[model samples]
Target: MDGLAGIVREAGRAGDRVGYFAALYRQVTVEVRTAVHGGLFDDGARMDRFDTHFGNRYFDAYDAWRRDQSGPRCWREAFGLLDDPDTIIVQHLILGVNAHINLDLAIAAARTSPGEAIHALRRDFLLINDILARVVVTMQDSVDALSPFMSLLDRVGARTDERILDFSVRQSREEAWYNAVLLAGQNEEEREATIQRLDIRAAVLARLIARPGSLVRPALELIRSTENDDVPAVINHLDNAMERSSAKQGTA
Candidate 1:
């Protein structure tokens, strides 16, 4: 988790938008680690391995993308948007979430518990959704601070926009679970094919997030127009907010 924090810090210092996701991800990892230490999971040891494997997926992809090497299509889509001026902070975040959850999460779960053992992982897997929910709420608060118009857009959109975002997360996680089951049952060759397909599907979702429908696009643009453009400051603010949120969660 410290390694992840370093990545976030470096990206923030560079004013890289990639740090947007990295900052939020580091917080989620912190929460997961805290849960592991508290013995919140059914198998703390397995979760340790699971979290490590899951994080490596993002780390490896980030490294590969930095080197201009080939990686999963989904991650490429997310990383490719780093310099895009039109995308808002939330778009960067959800793009990362789309790739990580929809593609990497399933593969990590399957690798952690192959075949029949995947069923046992289900309980712990569902538990992560709860963790994600909490972290996302905190993340939203941080983003709201940076993008004040976000709250106004939420109201003007009747919160339907927020609901749509929530629904996407829930649906993707459910699909990831089913995909993990399938991957666990497959042989090496078959698993590769399935993962390739998942990557394509996830990349498509990233595109949707980058370019939403007309109804939401105007509001998103308005929010983006009013957002703080200081990349480093935005990243640091998010990181600090998440740190405070994690501390509160730890105490609670």
Candidate 2:
């Protein structure tokens, strides 16, 4: 949790500062491992191995002096979350969009079409969505953790605390930027863009849920019912389906 906390702290830094998140990513894996015990992990031996492997891959990359050379490529994908709040919000919206894709992929795979080999492509898309969702949650948590600071800045006297005011102003700007892009409702252009995004998501969901496997059984069952009419239930059902799939597949 320390590492995770560290990452969140770093993300709250001034917007002008780059590489803050990359540094945080380098450290977060360590904290994540520390948070997991033998009960949460596979076992002592397997956990040890996981710790070592993750350390080498993630830590080494995080430590790299050059973004292209030394750091883990995964961090590069995540760093944008810190740079812009709008991107952070987009990340969450994309999850809902991707869930739509998962549903579409599942249906598509079940259809048994023979035009082209979409199975692999759809699978890849679903996997990417799953991965990105985790990243989005991390970013969301980081930003949420900073909300108190935002409120604090609003109260501080600008004349007496110029430096703090400057910091507050920057944070306000960053947060506003993120909210405008992410939390704001969709305009026609944005909605149209989202529809295109939905197509890709649908393709992936169709591929994954096409089969009546245990991994997606819950989701498939829910879809078969009228429960998807409730947005919260749909999200919960999807989250449950993914969790079950991860447990079955031995994913950490």
Candidate 3:
């Protein structure tokens, strides 16, 4: 968690757009760690291992991307957009989420619980959705601060807009779970093939997130126009908001 936070801080200091996702990811890790400490999972030890494996995928990819080395196609798609001035902050975050959740998560789960043992991980795995929902709600508030017009876009688009903007975390995670089950049942050779397919699918999703569609693009552009363009300041604000949210959650 400290290492993840360090990455977020360093990215922020360097005015890197990657910090947008890293900040949100650090918050998710913090919440997952807190849940583990609170005995939220059926097997805390196993959950710890699962969390570590899941996070390492992102950490490894981030390290590789920074070095201009090849990585998962989905992650490469996300990282490639970091320098695009036209791409809004929300797009950056969603690109990261699409890659991480759609591809890395399934692989991590399969690695954590191979074979029939994957069934045992179902309950705890579902619990992560709850944690994500909570963290994302709070993170949305932080994003709202960064882009006040987001609310206007939300009201204008309603459910259709939300589906486009939010990218349906619940649905994505559920699909990831199904993919994990499939991967768990496969041998190494088969699993690699499945992973390649998933990577392509996830990369496609990243492109959709980055480009969305005509219906939402104009509204997104409006929001982007109004957003705080200071990359480091935006990252710091998001990081601090997550910290404050964690403190409140701790007290509660």
Candidate 4:
């Protein structure tokens, strides 16, 4: 937790609005770092660069959005909800996941290759989905400790019988890679056009995360009542979940 994780922890301790997403992102960066160190890709250096670029988009948008500057539309919507006392922690986490994976990841992937060769990164691109999947699943449990009401989501997700909540994040990552390949094949103008369209779609998704309609919103509202306003504690839960996931991976 010395790099991104530590930075996120410090921010949370200071009640910075960006801390929750930063913690989630820290887990993702850690997973990529571990994957790179273990020689898990065709080009570790390239993966590192891609990962850095991907994470930096979120960081840059967080800064710009916080400062009321022009930024990615999805992130503008996502980060805009950070100041509301009614927004639950899980909503914040999901908003970050939606904006980062849905928008930033595609842009990063396309820029990493800048041509049809974006397809060459597919194997490792999907590997990132795996890492993100694991972190989110672990957080499903970790979040319960931070807020006792989060299990309401699990129950609601179950009753929905669609698995969309559980499935959307991974599905979004896959779509991100596909969109990246599409963007990679385009010229500058077409690429920007594609990104603008994707940004609109992603911003719509971010709104859903914040106000996800009748079936789930009531549960979320109830969950917000017992708010664990201790931002640092929530960040620690995320870090601990990452450590536990790594330990389990080591044993396995």
Candidate 5:
């Protein structure tokens, strides 16, 4: 009912809890929508199609995974955690990112251009990454803004640590690109198998995020304890931060 947890929580109650990531994802589609209408990408039309097609796959999976209809292992693991009481906001974000980037992203890229056409897709592919990266940095800031403990978390270094920042999204994305390259050359059947393997591998990551060790668990608890819990406020702050970041880079 509340917008604080974003659309994801509402989806859970609706039996499609994947809405947890869907909320953030819906925000991404808006950003991509703007880019499409404004011709922000190199091959604007093609990228727009790619973005839309890619986003829809995730949305479909959200429903399927929710109902036990069928989906990737990584996504299943991520969705299963939506109602988890011990899961912190960052962990929820991480679970979504882990499934999307480590798993979904590679699949999207491969499916976008099978075989040699994949090479042609690379430039535009990275272009989309550029757009997402800027939003990501600001989303990082938004978390610190919406969550009380993030202020203290920010003091750890001259800057906030990357792990806590995007929860290693930056690092994971780099590997995703490499994995995508491999997927591009595979056949559909092979790609399907590969997806399952990646999902299995990604499931381990979701586990660590949800059930981290003692040292990390305490810090995760602090952030959850201090979180605002106002879903609309949190989403608004995140959207505003995304817009500001976009403007700074002239992407808006």
Candidate 6:
């Protein structure tokens, strides 16, 4: 079985997290289709609708969707297929990291001078746009996986409800940071705003894990293992959040 560290690195390669996410989006979508068409073990029929280059069919679909509909709704509907809790958590992190890439591209476009850098930024923006569309589709597939389990859980009483709540909180904070950076200038104000937005969630998660007799060390170690980058900091925060949630679970 793949561990979280491997998963994080796999999702962050080639200095282009968006590309990593695009690959993951396709993989997860295939997995969902396999699960839906046959059992989880069967090789499902594949759909190559969004399999074009970063700018061709993929970007076209993304532009049409952006013009025709809302942004977050598309993702909420996309990954809603996956029924497994661990997969859903993984999807959340994937989506969050992908969102960060889009925001990063937007910031670069907003700040740089017109030249080769501008051309590169434009190219990057289109790629990011395609990635966003793919992520939405992938997220919808995950939602499908979660649907069947949701009803059973509702009937079976609260099971890991706190963990779900914690995930939601972290997802929101990640989204907020993405928005702040994407919409604002690349100046100090923008950095401060994004860092502040992320800080709130980090503080909450730290407190949650710092409770009496919590399993904070392993998670902290995991966070520390992540290489020095923006992605690593976010992973560290989530690790802490998970640690806190686990501690709370143990006490309960």
Candidate with maximal lDDT: 1
Q: How close is candidate 1 to the true structure, as a TM-score?
A: 0.93
C-alpha local distance difference test of each model: 0.86, 0.33, 0.85, 0.78, 0.68, 0.36
Of 5 and 6, the candidate ranking higher by TM-score: 5
Candidate 6 lDDT, 170-198, residue by residue in tens: 34433533443344444677655654444
What candidate 1 gets wrong by more than 4 Å, as runs, is: 160-167, 246-252
> How does candidate 1 score on lDDT?
0.86
Q: Of the pair 1 and 3, which is ahead by lDDT?
A: 1
lDDT of 2 by residue, 30-128 (tens): 433543442443243433443344334333433452345433222333332333322222222232223322222222222222124323234332333
Query: Model 3: per-residue lDDT, tens digit, 111-140?
Result: 999999999999999887677667777877
Q: What residue pairs clash in candidate 4, if any at all?
A: none
* TM-score for each candidate, following the candidate numbering: 0.93, 0.27, 0.93, 0.89, 0.82, 0.27
Clashing pairs in 5: 3-231, 3-232, 4-230, 4-231, 8-19, 8-20, 12-17
> Rank order by lDDT, top first?
1, 3, 4, 5, 6, 2
- What is the C-alpha lDDT profile of model 1 across 55-117, one tens digit per residue? 999999998998885699989989998999999998888889889999999999999999999
What's the lDDT for candidate 6?
A: 0.36
Q: After superposition, how far is residue 215 of candidate 4 from its true place, in Å?
A: 3.5
Q: How close to the true structure is residue 107 of candidate 5, measured as C-alpha lDDT? A: 77
RMSD of 1: 2.2
User: lDDT for model 5, on a 0 to 1 scale?
Assistant: 0.68
Q: How many clashing pairs per prediction, in order? A: 0, 18, 0, 0, 7, 24
